[model samples]
Target chain A: MHESPAVRGRRIKKSFGDVVALDGVDLDVAAGQVHGLVGPNGAGKTTLLGLLLGLAVADGGELEILGTPVGRTLAVPDGVAGFVDGPGLYPSLTARQNLSALASLRGYDAGRGVDDALEQVGLTDVADDRIRGFSLGMRQRLGLAAALLTRPRLLVLDEPANGLDPAGKHHVHRVITGLAADGVAVVLSSHRMDDLAALCSEVTVLATGRVVFSGPVTKLAAESGALDYRLLTSDTAAARRVALDTPGIRVPSGGDRVQRPDADVLVVRGAVPAVEELVVRLVRAEVAVRELAPVVAPLEAAFLALTGAVPTDEEVS
Target chain B: MTTTVTPPAVEARPAPVLRGYRFELVKLLSQWRIRVLLLACWIAPAGFVAAVSLQSVLPADTVFGRWMHATGWAGSLVVLDFSRSWALPLLTALVAGDVFAAEDRLGTWRHLLVAVRSPRRIFVSKGLASLTVLLLLVAGLAGSSIAGGLAAVGNHPLVGLDGHLLAPADAAGTVLLSWACVLAPTLAFAAIGLLGSVALGRSTMGLLMPALLAFALQLAQLLPLPVAVRLALPSHAFLAWRGLFTGPAQTGPLFIGLAVSLAWAVVATVAAYHLFLRRDFTDLTYDGSGRRVLVAGALPLAALVLLTFAVVTATTPAKGSGIERAKVEGSLATAYAHLYRMQTRELHRPDVTEAQLRATASCDKGGSRVADQGPGNDWRCVVSWHLPGATAVGTAIYQLDVTADGRYVADGDGPKEVNGYFQVRTSTGDAPNPLWQFDGNVDLLASTSKD
Candidate 1:
């Protein structure tokens, strides 16, 4: 409803003694958007997220959360609620008690709110059960439920999909999406590229505490450049022959150091048009292509490229 | 960006610190350890009384133990003084030492610190919650001890340090006041425990720290340290109650110890809060199941407080100069005459007055080679007095066991009918003869030179 972005951080710098956590990082997440942070270990993804949640203040930077500039206090703003690292839950308390305790801390008489949050996270079944016995996935779900209790306008979650089962994953996805649909801005960090692509409209790729790329997920997938196609066919010999003859399409050999052994699938590297040419030629040759797909998904490939991470053997081939 | 509208905000805005304290209190009371602590404090003293009452042998080593068979108040006092100085610090640690450290252990600091908005609030809330629990624990311990003692023994008169007899009503009042004075050292130790938790941020360390300090101080009592150093320690505050039962209620050490203990508490708590605020919570939160709930620790803050209070206490004259021979002799003779008169009344015999019975004591510390002086367990005294029907004077030989802190137990070794025994035949059934074996104390700081 307001003009300012839900979370706006500029040139943020945080250091622990000698190690720099976030250096000159700039982030802007609009309301009603699920902004994904993609980074490898120690890339300052969690650190940046921590600054937003007020778990830690930047050594230098300007941050505004929900129109309020974040201060040196170890607390989020009035409309902000999130957890970095993980939801720091009390294992001794039941899922319901954990939420109620947090709510009580905020002076919120969240008797019904606790039940609603638990039910919202599909944890109504184990609401009274202590979290000490909760599995990793269940804990993650409960963490989300705790964050939802405040009805945060800006929610920050670190690895929101880390330990979720299929059902739990779907439940979290729906909650995050629903929150965003209701005008909540969510910023979550995850190592899962699929999660980033599926849930986030915009992604920020951080490496060594600096944002290497920040834009729409669609624009990020476009940066993948070329593709490595895995061709599985009814006639492997025929498909392999057509792929070798096609221009701009080079079939990988067993001698290549990056070659991975595939018993019945042929790997080819080419631009989209070239791969399209090869597919047309294969169709003319009456070779039925059973499976033809990029060896690594586009978003993951672009993330691997932008972060300067070493490509996997399959992607390299 | 599209605007879909967010949910309505929560409107109530109470004081964050009060809310934080309430939350912490709820969480603290829910912990199994905290509950067990409360339960133990409630029942353990009663259990002690029950066990001690079943036997004839008195727990005579303690100040009030010898008279426990006569008065339940004495039994309560005995329990109150039994390892009191040593146990209180550890007990305080169990409640407070792990308070802040537990947040680190359970990885709940993120949630608590975030919601509370200020670390100061968190500190204050946790401190207040711990103090609340400690107050409850102390009340329970004191109440149960008195209840157990009254139930186990009847409300007979108790003996005080100056060998004065306290009526049942007076004894009850004194015990309550002693427990109140106990809060001085207790708060000091609790602050020390909080300092340990905040400074170390580890449960085991927090728990071990207060226990270690307590043991060290207890052991320190054996060493010939400077009296000034001894007077300054938070541990020294435990002995503050000694002055309360002394003749004229020697209040110097009581007031000094109260000031010293308060200084220790305030400074240590400040140091802990300072450390807590400066800490950066950048470490990854531990989600391990191996985590122990708020364990307990010690801190340099205790040492800092010790030296600080010590410096202040050092400027004053140090008490604990040991019981004087004359003071002991006088206290003993006065107690003997008082109890003898009371004993005659119980026997339905002719009444005797303290003025008529000229009781005098001649005591030697070690042997005939030594003059009657100073504090020692080996004291022999001849208490000669007059009886109403006897023509000649009667004498009672008493073996005196004295302590450096100005208390003694005098064992009567005369004929049972004349001096006393465990029980004596009285007109109203068998009754406790107050003249048998008696407990008393001399003011260590009382004027020793009787001119």
Candidate 2:
């Protein structure tokens, strides 16, 4: 028999008192897919993740996780494991003890999984150290290790890379991608567009407790209206003249202009097709197109256009 | 490419509740706070007994305090009595009050809730763990007190409240039973602490509220409430074991106290379980809005108190006239005889014979015409005894106070030459003997009259 989607929610609504944390939100996640959840702060990312993990029940609408429909009872579907609002841990316990405690609570022995998870998170060296002494990055890695102990088929993580160094981030990305390759459904919420762009096959953009966009990463960029680009060429004056002369491309005026006026670069704002047309003209005009890059990443530009504000650091995490 | 071996799935178990309980027990035992509290429980009582034994005079305010320095068994009884008043409740709260709130404090509620589907199961597991801890503390306190008492004072016959003497074995058993009797109320306090923990979501509130409630209830017992109302309070149950040390054991209060304690436990636990099942764990730091909890908790308590009041009002009769003359006369006569014999033997007096002394007593309740029964502070009794060198037989009027629970205090107004002490001639010598002398006061034994 074919397996159902790992998570399915239809117009799920959740409210706390007068504040609507989630409003008419719909989501679908399938096995072997990494679904990225992107939203500004207070956009209901954590609330939705909480619902998926069974830390809470949706106030209204249907939610199905791991093929089972969720009711009012607070319960995670089988094969679901993750953490929200950072992982909750006993500060006094060693990393190994924390994992062992969680394992024992679930009625299974840690066996070799504890060590394997620790090694996977690059925390094997400090496995015996109490969590009280762990840095934020170490704690986040330990949380991932804890989730791995369950051998979960569906993993939900909120800002799994919140405090990780570049190396730690690489390890986490590997583990998450590795899990997906093993047919696990992963739902990750993060503010880092690069990580999302790197790992997510599909992304869901939320704004004001509603979904603004959901599809492949390419669609998000394709749908964004226009973005500013930093252009560098062998001939700056020629590139600037060619760019301004190109149809549908405009050199931004006033305070919106590029900060480095003396440098051999031209900042232009226009749709991707228009920008492509300008690049074509530059090359044809023998003003070699040395470089062409959006000032903000396509994902981040789209996020800004969709959410109306640059994602704050706290929001990204 | 690398390959990994997948571990086998764990076997299914029949009792998930038991597993959850075991998990909770493990969590609690791993905490250093619990270990230290238990160690204090074991050692504090023994140290208290040792300190009290070193004092020349016994503490007379607490029940059995007068006998604390008398024998090991009595010392244990004194500690047991003191524990019932406050220490038992506090000890129970030490574990039960923290079991649930600690989850909130440590932000582990989300973790545990995600792993354990049913909140009710978690509640039960935590409750059971708290009970287990309480049992351990009680056992430690009891064991330590017994050991300390045995080492400090030698085994001796214990004096009962009704002037009856209990053998050494019976005294030991009675002491154990007294400790056992308080367990029912201690469990009730544990349930209350658990309820507070769930309702308040703070360990400090959970720990302090139950202890304060216990203290308040104990103070309420001092009021002249009807027996039924008194029986409803868990604190009253702590004193139910006092009946066991009487001439004929009063098991009525013992059984009633146990039932009342169980009732309170059931009510508190059920309420706590209900609240826990409905609680939202999404916000780990929610301090629980106090108004709703107050209403939830207050309704049940008000209903219970009103129900107790109604029952007590309907069933209880008016207080009896005063201490019964026959019961008091019999108790006083027997106690005086024992004291006189002890004095004569100690003084090496041989000429004074028990029959020749011929102690006689007459008692009345402040000149009332009503039947001499019940409890009062104004009962008067006159005793006439043969003096060693007096021309006429001496008469002394004793002012007596009787407590509702069947205890008495008596003060004698005799000639200055007699020094307000009961005097008798020794059997082996001509020296005069003083009876019932402790802290310059004469001790009298009183009995509860069966009406």
Candidate 3:
């Protein structure tokens, strides 16, 4: 094992004057694992990121990075690297120069030079170009390249995949996985549960600065005892009757359905086995299933269940 | 919980400070605003010189006027020095204000702290880098002004504050010294800008506040402070070298100005450093994670500047009767004494004493008085003196004006009181008639006669 609870926070509380941003929150992230921090707007997701970045100090807490305590004079502990809100970059500098500047800032040799880091992030062709000309996706990649220059052992990224295209998101997911495989602990905060589901082995759900649930994503699914399913059918009435007739299943009431107008799909919230049995019964009833998918992850569903609404991308961004 | 100690081989290594600082310095230099500010320091002076030299397009008495007449070039360049007295300070603050503040604006404060473990080195290195840039600018501006003034004005005697002619060498010395004098006070302003940057974590107000304060001080100095108060001000250093153009030079104010400027620079730098050390690192950069950043020592600096100005003004010497007498008599006695000593050594012996000089001397080589001394004698004399030389002695002059308000007075030569008729004799010169005569100190055109 690399260490103890990789990032341990006990009864952490922070406030800006009278406004409580983080209210007595406790979280633990272990090494060799990717932990997702999911929360609604003003629920202290960004505040938690700031603490991880050593950018903000908590009012009351016993916090540690790599088992070493962080106090008043908090320097981003050794082996820690990430963005709280967004990466700070020199706009006039080229993509390569921005990474080089950061490389030098952290005193890292950045051995292969700016070109090498850009190459790793698939930004090599445009590396020499100024950051001012880069698109949002390109800027995100540039931020990633700069962070990688440090070869951080503990990476804290806030919505790292927000502006990333599918390819870029895949690249980030792979890069984060690779860092974790090398024992670099990853703490990522994002509203995109699919990205979190794909990248994190463990997820920490926060609601109003308090941790509602934290553990493996499987544990969150098992603990929630349910999943939201999105089903499409040619014979909607037949599929509905079959789903209703199935044992341990009931048709989601209007109150339980989360309508998706754009997708034209009805979200049926039910127990995991009940929803699973409904899918089987629909097949038996000769209902043509055009689409069958979970609305989102059990963790995301659990996140909404605890917080009572979907977390918009803006909340993390 | 038992803490596990990792073997030496398993422990992670930390980053070095030198590498981090160099990176920071490079980033600072690469900033467009900083580069432009530095470039201006070098280029502005040269541009001013070139423009000034090409001012006159036709033949004229004044060099700038002549250039303008001959070449159709504007005279704007020749007056750069006058304008730069205020402009250079503002320009210096522009770059200095952003020195530490840019990091905060960019959200790199915490990032830098992570890289460099000690805040002290970061503070020192950045402060030094900014100061180096400031010094370079001062040098560039000074060089440009001196060279430009010479090229524009050529070898002709430059105009003085009192409109007297100044020879080329004298003018060069004055301009160069004046430019150098600007540095002492500028250091304080530069430090203030840095202090602002560190506290506010932003450049906009950092640059503006100091320039504004400097302007305010200039205005405050105009209030009813004593001559000593104004003389003691660091701002007086701004006008100190102007005295070099005055006829028969005096350096009292110049030296006083230099000393005061030096004191301000030292005190400001020390205080700025001390505050920087105790300040919370969280305030060094702006994350805006919170509503506001609380700078540890900003109020103290503002207080110090205000207090310094207030104390200086309050205790400033008053220009009363005694002060007026000291200025007038002091200048007069010194000038006369100076000329008297020189002439006495040439005409007679060098060892002549005051008592001997006062004794009655014969016009025809006989030990006889000019007139029989009596209580009612109207021909009474009063003698004052003026000193001489550039190194130590200063130039002064006295005038004998017999106002209608004049009453009976006594003479030092004889024990007699006569109807006052202001007969003035200096330590060296012959006594002027009971009318008005100029010995040396007061410029007839410039002086305001009370009577």
Candidate 4:
């Protein structure tokens, strides 16, 4: 028999007073799969993540985590672990003490693999320092270390890469990828498009409390409309002229065609097929197209289009 | 991605509540603030005992203050009485009030709830931990006071209420029992503090609100109201230990007081737990708006005040109605007999028996025209007693301050020669008894009729 999905939500709904935080949200993630959630501010990403972790209960609809049905008691399945809206920690306690407290509260032997978990998050050096003095990056890493102590089967992290240095982000990425390899289903929400594209095989995009897109990473790229591209050519004039003559390709105002400010650079905006046609025409016309790349990554371009507005601080948090 | 080896499964336990309780205890004990508070509790009694022992005059206003300088046990009793006013409630509230709100202040509620699985379990664990800390504080303070008293003043027979003498061992037991009695009300205050903490979501407010409320309630007891209304106040239980010091050990008020106090504790704790279980942890911000304050704080207070008024109205009779003439006459006769016997003994006239004194008293309220029956502070009594050498009966006027609770303080204007300490004979051939002396004023409660 096929194993059940690690998480399944059907028409999940939640509201805070008059604000409808999540309306008819449905999501699923199988074991060993890393699913990415992307949305602008106030798109209900945090609300959905909170539901998965049992920090909150949906006002209406079905939610199942690790094969257990969610209830109104705010209790998730045993294996669900992660942080939303920043991790909760005791500032008076040291990093090591915080983890031990969590372990003891969970009825586990605190001495069991606390050190290993600390080392996994690269927090072993400052484990004895009080968390009050810790930087945001350090606190975020410590939160990850706390979650790892439970050996969770399903990880739900909201902006896990927040405030991380490059090395800390690399350590987190490795840990998340390693956990997924061990059949731990990870559902990560982030605004960093590169992190999502690099880590997630499937992505879900939320807009205004509803799922706007859900599929493989490639599908999201395909769904993106015409995106701007930065083109570098040996013959910028020939490339600009070819672009203007093309059916669906248009040289933007700042391109060589308008100002000729940059001798060998051009800017174009068009669909992939039209850009390809331009490239083909340029090569056939001996324009010598050296390089062509979208100005922004497809995931970000699609996210901006899907969200259609800048996110407010409240929604981002 | 590479798969890592899985560790062995840890043994699972069924009792999450016990684990949560243990964790809460660890968290509470680990705080430096709590440790310092307990240390202060253990050490402050010695300084207080030393400071109070140096006073030339006795602290005569409190229950056992008159004898506090005369005996160590009385000194402990004095401390116990003083602490009941505010110190005990504040001590219990200091820890119990912060028990849950500290988690909110530290942003650990969500973490704790997610780990513990049951919010009720978390609530129970926190409450139990707070109770444990409160018990420890009480024990520490009691033990320290007893130790300080023993070291500063030697143990001696305590002067009981109404001129009854308590043996040294009995006095020590009574003092200890009084301290123990205060614990019930202290726990009630703790419950109040816990409720405040859960409702307010801030540690400072939790700590201060219960203490302020208890102080206000204690002040309310001093207001002129029916005896039943006063009895209903939680502070009434703090004075219940006085029953243990009285003759024949009246336990009616003690039992009733304990029941009232425990009922308050149970109600507050249950309400706190109910609120906690239903509260949403996602947003722990306390909205201290006018409407919220009216609903959360003022409504309960208004209800309590109305209930007190209703009880007073239902129980209190019309004017000129509380004290009965027969009861007053009987109690005055008995008290006069007791005091007159002690007086003759102090005057070296032990040959005079209570029967020889033949005390008969007539009492009136405010003035002779006013009926001698209502509960009022102004009361007067005329007593005719036989003096050993006098040819006829001697009449002395006494001013009595009568309380609604059947307690009275009588000031006698007798012979001027008997004002100062005089020679006393305890038994045949005993040389001038010095310790057992008499004052012009006497305090006593009315006698309970056996029928």
Candidate 5:
């Protein structure tokens, strides 16, 4: 559609004392898109999100939100709204009152958009109940509703899926997707690979305050070239023999990454063609295949490969 | 909030500060604790009035309590004076202490900033909201006190500090004016509470630190500091209105008190505002964590206060001993003359006007070695007064407890056979005498009294 990106942050540098939170990072989000930020702990995900929400100003960077350049002062353009480090909600206020308070603070008429926000987040039932007794999931949902009160063009959230149950998770997912459909740009940080795979078309992987990978979700999954395939067959010995005989396949006798608790299953590692050949050979050998699947999901494997890499012993003091 | 297919026409939005201020006001008013504090401010005074009215001994030890039964104005005055001790400081602290810290406590600074965007807007709005509530708090207590006092006690004359009987109307005026004057010091404390909140970033510290600082300043005020030094302290504004009811300009600390008051308020508020601006809301752990005592920030403020004290003390010399010999003489003789006239009228004796009784006093604090320039309970004055046609002068030794602000309680040592006893014989019955123990203020800080 060639729409101008809703957010463009370049070479952003933010530091707290001597701790380098973010060092020369870059990010972009287009309209009507869900952008996932995936990073390990202390990966500057929250710091980046804080900058997007105007909770902080970048010490050294250019950040444009909704096409307006952010200033040195703590501010983003008016249409940008969100929270980092979990949603900062007032426990003393009711769910509805919290939304109303945000609306009032945002210069909207009181109660003008509160009900819509609550209904959007599926919090209408507990709208009038004080949030002090609310579960973390409920508070997260309420925080999302408060963001909705802004009708933001660009939304930034940190760990939105934290503390959410299945039903609440789906509810929030639906809201995020609906907002993206409505042409809002959303940039949310999550440790959950499945959440990013489900909701995000574009994902940015950060490691040590630098972008290790940034592209489509499909591209992120493809970053890992090798696969750990779990193999099970009616004739296990026969299938193992056929898989061992197959080309371009390594079935490790002393297993590591492909290790499984199931004693009857054989673990193999190779490219997609090698695994396909092993499956075909198993059928040809008349060892009926019961199951053959990647032991770790592609996205998780890709995420771990991209962000979970530990520094060498020599790199540490 | 639905996004429209067509762009809506641009409309002027309210200033972000105004919007935030309105919400902050609503948020503050919505809290049950705030409402309860306000209710306590209003309702607690009535209980005090009732308690004082039911007691026969009267609160004679209090500054304005000796005439609690005589007039409602006395009750109001008692509340006005007593609130200064701790109630007003704590009250201002209770309102402003947590306004900023509560956001940090709740981790809602991000939530609020997402809406307001500018921390400056948040700071100004929250401060304005706190000030508004404080104004309401003071007004509520004042209104309730005046109303409760009048309803509990009858409107009668008030015994001024100078020992003159003030008519009920004028007394009420004086009481209300005193209460109104309390706002300056109240604002100064409120600013300190805000500074504590921003700098400390904890609700408990924000609430208690400003109050503790006020107490510390109050203790400093009592240290026989120079009159300029005393007047420069915000705490002294509480006692500044004492001399106003004497039918002249008794507010000697008026100008300096006001200047110091606004200076403290502005400086504290500005310091708080800067700290707020410097805050980094990058994490949810916002309240008093990750930050320790800012010695760089605090030392300058402390130095400013100390420098103000040093400059004023050095520049404005306190030449004489505490409560000048002339002021003590004038106050003792005036109080004695006024009370004697009343006593003579009740006893059906010839009235001796204040001028007819030529009174003189010689006072000293400590022994002859002491400077006698500051406040102390060690003050002793020998007062002599002559009757219109009496041959001999009557002398009495008076022990005085004088405060740094120049108000004193004097006890006269005289025989029961004279009018110096606790009570005096009148034609109708024994009437309470005002001469034996009397309260007076020596206007040492007054412009005309600089000696």
Candidate 6:
């Protein structure tokens, strides 16, 4: 199997006068997979996306997109499509007209294909509506449709799901999944960890323009120091007994203890799958376990630990 | 996890500027504003010529002449007039002002840069599109002027105020070329608007600055100054177009007008290109770009002002007339006797034969000194003659004004001038004579005797 990256960057740095936007970053996105980049505000995730989209060039190190090597003076690559920051849209143009203009520029025979792309983005009904009237989510979808019209091999999207409702997010996720299934590489930068987790099998967490962690999401969860377990039990004593026997487990203390002592409830921390094994063992031991949930959400906990920045309330959601 | 890779069905190719430009043209042409502007381009010159032509035909008492008559080839469009000098510039401003500014007003500059492949490409494409539109707009104005003039005014012998009739061939050539002269100055305005559009990043300033500059140039030309500064201004081109109508038309001013406007356009366009390409537009702060300071603080305005001031002061007359001693009585007696002899011998009556007139004038005043005829300063005079059974009378007028350089004044006020005609009224009861007038101020380049 080929190990070469479809897109790669090493030790990339970008600065705007007195402001350091990106510093000593490394990233690689292989073909046929979706790579999610997540970070808190000012973490330089958008900067990295800018680098990939050819909107900004790194000040140091080498960057590559698809098979094309890039330098600080590199032009936007031929077959790469995506949005950095937010999509640039002609607000006066109708959705279909915008797509058609893009298609015409690319010399594509956009005939009925613009309609098809609109349908794919679930914007067919509003294809004739001017983009000025579109919601943020709808505009995002239209941008996606524009990208799809070019049939790009590498897609770099920044915070694409920020304004999407559940169904809209689902639709976006499905479309991204379908693209990945067709062997298109996607580099998605988002502030929403849940969205990243749902859509990306592999993830990179950046902090201060450097990648703090990059690998499979499951690996990140497993390697995390501790997993939070939410427990529901018919008998509190039985759940406590199971947890006590479980090695490498700690129960919440102080105000963290919210459950009534006579009723069934418990909270504990351990390795994720290990805690799951313990719960199975407890059920086998005939202690009724009603619910199990992670209290220290792995993605959230990882984000806080990696960034070392306090997660805002919005981020926690 | 194992991933499955499938070969893509197709590869995408990059787009070219030609295709991009076509789309741009489509957008520009589809706008209702552009349609209205084009319509105005057609109507304005036609309407101007029609109005002038109607005035010319109604009454001879009105200050109407062949110059007011629309050129024969351009049908109803009046090619020569004071109103067109200002009107054409305004018409140019109406269209050229909005070229790049419209995009800024619509908030499309950033959007276009992103949607297009690059800003450099966008700049070039948009510039070309604007130039194309300007050409079309100028053509429409010129074409309508020609068409309207020919249609509205009947093709008759155009007797100029000087009693010279412009032939069909000469009039056609002059009107066409004159309209073209307007284009040279219009380009300067176009460039100004474009620079404003890019530098200020607002459409209104783009339009306003150019229009204002053109009007400013026109005002500057009116100030007391040398011929050079007057000729250098963009508005001079408007006046340069007047050359086509005048007898023995001088091409020098037209060439100077062309050169000045071309230089202005080139300098402005180059400056605009530099600022547009170098400025960090990512920030998109319109005012903070520093373009205004650079453009406004340039040395050209100061240089032109100082040059004008120095030239005007140095050239204008120090006081009033220095030759005030050459006054009326002595010269008036000689002038009358000389005038009497010339009338008796040369002027003929309706009933008298030419042979009979010669026998009447062997008078001593028949050959008087030239100086005895009149005072140099007197431009207007009345004289009498004898026609068959009636005393024939007429006016022999002279108007003189020295140049700013204190040059001598030249006098020839037979008929036409800028303001109106000075008629030569004869008392003979013949058909009513066509009155001639001196319409403009006269300045002496050199004396006919000295030449």
Q: How far in Å is the alpha carbon of A279 misplaced in model 1?
A: 4.2
Candidate 6, residues A1-317, lDDT tens digits: the string is 66567687777777778777677777878887899998877778877776676656567766767766775442556667877656666666789888888788766767787988899999999988878788989988888888788787888887788678789989989999999998899999887778788988888888876788989988766545665667877767767777878777766552134455555457777776678778887888898887878766788777777778643433322
DockQ-based class of model 2? acceptable
DockQ category of candidate 1: acceptable
Model 6 docking tier (incorrect/acceptable/medium/high): incorrect
True contacts kept of each: 0.37, 0.30, 0.22, 0.28, 0.43, 0.15
User: In model 5, how large is the Cα lDDT of residue B286?
Assistant: 60
- How do the residues A242-310 of candidate 5 rate in per-residue lDDT, one tens digit apiece? 777889987665432233476477777778888888888888889888778886788877877788663
lDDT of 2 by residue, B1-451 (tens): 1122222222222226777787788778878888987897799878877778667666655666655555667777777878887788887777898888888887778777766666878888899888998899898888888777767766766666543557889999998988898889898888888888888887477667679888888777655455556665667678778778765575655776787788778778887888787787876558855664576665786676667546544544312322367666655544454445455555555656546666666778768785565567677777666756666876656666766544565555554333254344433222222333211111112224442
Question: Residue-wise lDDT of candidate 6 within B171-213, one digit each (tens)?
Answer: 6665667667777777766766667667766535555666677
By summed lDDT, the worst window of 10 consecutive residues in model 6 chain B runs over B442-451
lDDT of residue A98 for candidate 6: 81
- Quick one: best TM-score, which candidate? 5
DockQ of structure 4: 0.21
Q: Report the alpha-carbon TM-score of model 6 versus the true structure.
A: 0.70
**Model 2 bad stretches (over 4 Å):** A17-19, A229-269, A273-295, A308-317, B1-15, B223-228, B316-451
Clashing pairs in 5: B321-B372, B321-B373, B322-B372, B322-B373, B322-B374
Model 1 agreement with the true structure over B367-397: per-residue lDDT tens digits: 8787565556689888989876678888888
Instruction: Give the interface RMSD values of the models in order.
Output: 8.7, 11.7, 6.7, 10.5, 9.9, 9.2
Q: What is the DockQ of each candidate?
A: 0.38, 0.28, 0.24, 0.21, 0.31, 0.16
Report the lDDT of model 2 for residue A40: 95
- How far off is residue B118 in model 4, in Å? 0.3
User: Against the hidden reference, what TM-scores do the models get?
Assistant: 0.87, 0.82, 0.71, 0.81, 0.89, 0.70
lDDT of each: 0.76, 0.74, 0.58, 0.73, 0.77, 0.59
Task: Indicate the fraction of true inter-chain contacts that candidate 6 also forms.
Answer: 0.15
